[model samples]
Target: MLFNIINNVRIICAKIVQIAKSGHPGMPLGISDLFSILWFYFYKINFLNINSINKDKLIISNGHGVLIQYVLLYYSNIYNFNDIINFRKFNSKTPGHPEKNEIIDASTGPLGQGVGIGVGIGIKNKINSFIFNKKINIINNKIWIINGDGCMMEGVSYETTSLCGVYKINNIILIYDSNNISIDGLIVTYFNENIRMRFTSLNWNIIGPVSGHSYYNIFKAYKLSLKSYFPTLIIFNTIIGFISPCKSYNEVVHGSIFNKNEFNFIIKNYCIKYIFKKKILIDNKIKYFKYFIFFYKKKYFELIRILNFIIPKINYIYIYTKNRYNCINKSTRFVSSVLLKNIFILPEITGGSADLSASNLTKNDFIGFFKKKKRYRYIKYGIREFGMSVINYGINLTKTGINFCSTFLVFMSYMYSSFRNFCISKIKNIFIFTHDSFLIGEDGPSHQPVEHLKSLRIIPRIIVFRPYNFIEVIICWNIALKLKKNIVCIILSRQNFINNEIKFYNVKNIIKGGYFVLNKKKNDLIIVSCGADLEICFICSKYLNKYFLINIFSIYSSNLLNKQKKNFKNIFINKKILFIESSNDNSILKYKSLYTFILGINKFGKSSNTKELLKYYNITKKNIIKICLYIIKKKF
Candidate 1:
């Protein structure tokens, strides 16, 4: 039966790819044997009840070859043969690679993220079982992932591998496809590193040189993995392009489609167990493994959903009051620490920093670092930014809790690829970035973020907030919580800030994402600003108001304001708007119309005090006054 499934998958997938004229057939053929073994014997899943959390799941980390899974989906009666025929077509559920589906929890195409996502899913289950195991049987399951040689070389893979080792997350099984061939050529030419020594050193349970083709050896290896106490990495030695007549064990077959002659050879000789007489017909599919459930798990699942959130020591009234300041005039990060203390107290919110907890203001005394076998809440994600982001995406799929991670704003480049996935996948994680711009003195230009604000705002589905005051900070947090569908980023500052007047701003207006502090029936100019830059612009506006009737509009989130701009067009369109920001002005240039000028940083900042950096970058009061004059002179 397993032989029939394997051969049928190959022939069907070959035809599916042939129809598209483009699809990876080599991996589908090469990895078909192990895949068949997993579905028929090892993996415990009911395709009808795929949403159930008690069964084993297969995470295809190397999604370059996802046609194999589509074939399996067809066998289970989840997708008809026609859906398989329409693989990789627009508006079709079967995309080129694994996207978010009923079976696959997370979308994956970029290599190495699925490894981290698998670990992330395992991490949430581990934490939940640790916290609430005695309360109920809280959804225990194992995460199995397959990665090729290409995934092993990716730096994000190493980051996640190290994180998995550190956490000792034991419920994960990693299958390494040691085919030694990538798209370019044999990996031996560039990636000849020893997998055994490398993974063993990282504290993984290693089993290898197992026959990827031989069902007996693969079954024996899986049995050993089930008995292991640590996360396992099984190295399967297999042939790339396993049964293709022309390009077996060759890079050409890795991504290219088979020609007519080569495919004919396969249909005639290799497809012995199965015959392609008509369209690939799916069986009743009881052959795919199923675990018996005596009753529905909805009751036990709800037991783990604990909600014990409490208001902070600082009164909730004061947070929403007319004077929402600590009165100490502390830094925005300091202000953030107060909010994080309350947010961390919530049972479901897990967070940590990428080795910058002290600086990122993520240090929590309530729930300390999660050590091996410890019931602590904080996850010490030590310096791995990309790994942290991808793991958060995995955690999001669990649907039990929301998680967050933090780092300096400048380090966003490190995790950008994973961040893009976070937005694309619509993963909910509170991404906190401190030291928002060049304000962090002595960190040098390398640590200062000039275009980072613009970079984050431009991503399609992300909501970026750079709040300027305490009320706006609270408002951004509230707005983020309500906008659960979008991933939210809170950009913080290193400078001290206080606004007694800002606290009196209407909560209703602030909730709209951004609003004007001073607006009248008539005004000469509009000064748009946000974050630390807003404070300077506000002060400068007060002085400029004597000559020009300036209206100050503070934007908490550029994207959020963009949505509500139909009512606020008078503030920008057909008017001379002077945009002031400490970072690059490109983020605000989207509001450009009529006659507009941006008195903002366009170059990298240097190592210096905030005052000198301000002067050098022309972000000073003198510069603001000069720009305002120039804006008034410019014609519409």
Candidate 2:
């Protein structure tokens, strides 16, 4: 029966290949036996209860070979064989890659995300089963990821793997499909690394170079993995397009469509034992789906109830009250910690820092650390920022909680790809970045995020908040939790500031895109700034007012101008706006017409006191006065 199911899956994959005319059909053909073992024997999947808390997860990190996943899903009775046959077609349930919202877990076309998300899911289950003592038995859920040489070679895999080892996430298993051939050619032409030794060094259990076509060997590997108390990497040596007569050990067949004649010839050679036609087989698959539906509906509502009970309540109170200072302190990290404590009621809220728990303020006294055989409140993701972010997003897919990860602002670049995926998936995650901007002096330019703020701002739908004080940081956190649609990047300062009587309404105004911090004085020029630069604008405003009669409006959101509003129009019309920032002046160049003059650093900063650095960069009160004069002279 299992072999028949596998044969049906192979036929479905072949039809999908014919439709898409593009995809890696090689793995589906080569690794069918391993997938059969995983789906039918080892994997603990309740198709009737697809969202069951204790269900196993399968991540296809090598998404180019999506046919394999599609075939497996089809055979597992998740969908009818027609869905697999219609793969990569418009309006089809199955796209070229797997999308979590569409069918399964998070999307994985972007190599290494599957493994990274698997690590994250494992981390989440570990925390939930251990800390809450929910006796959830959910942590028993295993994460099986089918990785490729390409995925293993990606830096993100290493980052997530290191995190897995540090957290001792034993439930996660990775099957590295060592086909040795990439699109270009054999991996030996461009790649050679001691993968087994490398994983061992990271404290992961290393399993075979098992024969990819052997179900018994694959099952044995999975059994051994279950006995181990650490992550397992099962390496499989196999041909890329095995059993295809036209393509013999060829990289060309890795991701190209086979012509009809070539496909028919290959199918003839492979389908000798099976006497099935595509049209007649469709009815049989549909009949099987009817049985599956009965099982699914029986368990579906129960799982839904469990999800509702555990899922964090989406609170909008924070949206109304922007006073984050009352809840926490001026530090962004501190605010995040406090928010985590208050919002622990939400089962889906899980987070970890990249080895900077002490400095990042991600660790709170209330949150416990996840230990071996004991899940803790916080995940020690180690120093793997890239992996940490990927895992954070993955945990989001478990439908169990909200997730987050933290690191130094400079290290954010390492996880840019994963961050982008987070935005794409619309995962409600808070990245508590500390030591924001050049305020962390002497760490040098490498550590300073001079352009990082603007770089993150470029990503569409990502909310970048640079709070001037602790209160604003709290407000930002609250706003982030409420606006779950976008990725929230909260930039924190190293120095502390007083949380003055900044009205929640004003902060709320800021969240609406942009708001005038101070009403435009009849005779004063408007001053605009964000983050640490806001303080400079405040000081510069006072200096400019002393030198010349001017009104200073602290503009927070630069993108606010794009919104059509009557009040905003009246504020910007025929007015002299002076924008001040500590970073590059070009950061606000797009709004040059709205501003009379832009004062900011155009060159790299030097090692010095924060004050000295501000002064050296000409971001001082004197420079502000000079720029205001220059704008007045140039315009008036």
Candidate 3:
């Protein structure tokens, strides 16, 4: 039966690649038996209840081998055969890489992320077990990651491996596919590291050098890993593209397409009859799996009840709003810290910064630090930006909680890949980027973000919130909570914002992404700004009040502003709009159709105070007034 399944998988891989006329066939062919053993015997999953919280996670870190996963899902009756037939087609669930909201829990394409993601899920599981009173380990599901030679080489994976060891995170099995072949011919050409020694030094229980083709060896490793008390690394020594005619075990066939003749030759080389039962019968057979069905139903209700408790009550928002109104003039991070203290009613809200908790103001006073020795809320992720980010995404996959990570805005580039993965996965996670812009004075150019806001804005489905004041922070946080699936980048200021009395401070209007602070049906000119720039706009508005009927908008999100209806967005576009921003990037230019001017710096900032930086960059009320006067004189 096992032989039959492996042979069927080989056949499926050939067919999918042949049909798509594209895709990496080597990894799927090489790792067929490993996947067969995983899904058929040990991997706990019911196709009918794929969303079961208790179901073990299977992350294909080497997503080039995604075809093997698709084939398994099809054969196991989790996905229809139609999905297989339409592999890599537009609108099909079977993309080249595994996408989230599908059978796969975490999206895996960019190598090494799945390792970090697995660690995150494992951490979440351990925390959840504590949440369930420690008596019943309801959320203890294994996070199985299948990483290839490429994944092993990636630095992100190594970082996560060390972290898992330091924290002693368990229920994580990282299977290293040591095929020893890369697109460049051989891994030994550029990569050489003692795998077992490295993992041993990192404190991971090493379980391999196992034969990939042997079911017994794989089973024994899995059994030993389950009984062990820490993260396990099972290294599988296997031949790349084994048992195929089209360049079998050849580096040249890494991502090569197979022609009909080549496909036929490969099938013939396998030389196995296709005698598996039909899909309909397979589906029916799974329904009769007594143990799987019972646990599926039990976990379904358990998750629902847990989610209900985790979701904050409506009154919390009201109370949170009231607290925001009473907030004193302070740095946005200080306000965030105060608000965090009041709004941590939900137990699932857990996270910490990369050793910038004091600066990022992410440490919730009520929630204790999440120590590895005990289950708590915050994780003191000491300076692991990349690891912290991927883990945040992983924790979100658990569906038991929401996670937020914080660091200096400039350091976002360090963890950009993880953010890209989050975008690809369409996971709802919060990222608090503090010390935004040149206003984070004296930290120098290295710590200031100039193009970072523009870079974050371009990512699809990501909401970049640059709140101007205490009220907008609350509004943006409210929106972040309500959003179903998106990455919210809350860009904040280091300097304290001037507390100007907001006219018509309706919090609901903040959802529109941009709202008029000086509500006007008709105006000679409009001043648009965001974050710390709002203070300049307020001053500029007063200076220009005698010369022109001015309208000012505190535009928090450029993406959200563009999303507004044409008539609504045109209100600002109809007038002569002057955009004021600290960064040189003219992101707000997209919203206006009229002849508009932007006041910003196109160069890096120097180490100085906020006043010096603002003046040096001409991001001042004086500059705003001069520009407005020049524009008004030219128009007249």
Per-model TM-score, in order, reads 0.92, 0.85, 0.92
Q: Write down the RMSD of all candidates, one decimal each.
A: 4.4, 5.7, 3.7
Give the per-residue lDDT digits (tens) of candidate 3, residues 305-416.
Answer: 5565345454646655576655556777877776677667666688789999888988865777777444687888777899889888888888786778899989999888
lDDT of each: 0.77, 0.69, 0.79
How much is the lDDT of residue 551 in candidate 2? 53
Give the alpha carbon lDDT tens digit for every residue of 319-346 in model 2: 3256453633254455555656666554
Candidate 2 has an lDDT of 0.69
Q: Candidate 2: where are CA atoms >4 Å away?
A: 76-82, 131-139, 272-306, 309-348, 497-508, 521-523, 546-571, 585-594, 633-636
How high is the lDDT of residue 500 in model 2? Answer: 49
Candidate 2 positional error at 467, Å: 1.0
Residue 314 alpha-carbon offset, candidate 3, angstroms? 5.1
Candidate 3 lDDT (Cα, 0 to 1): 0.79
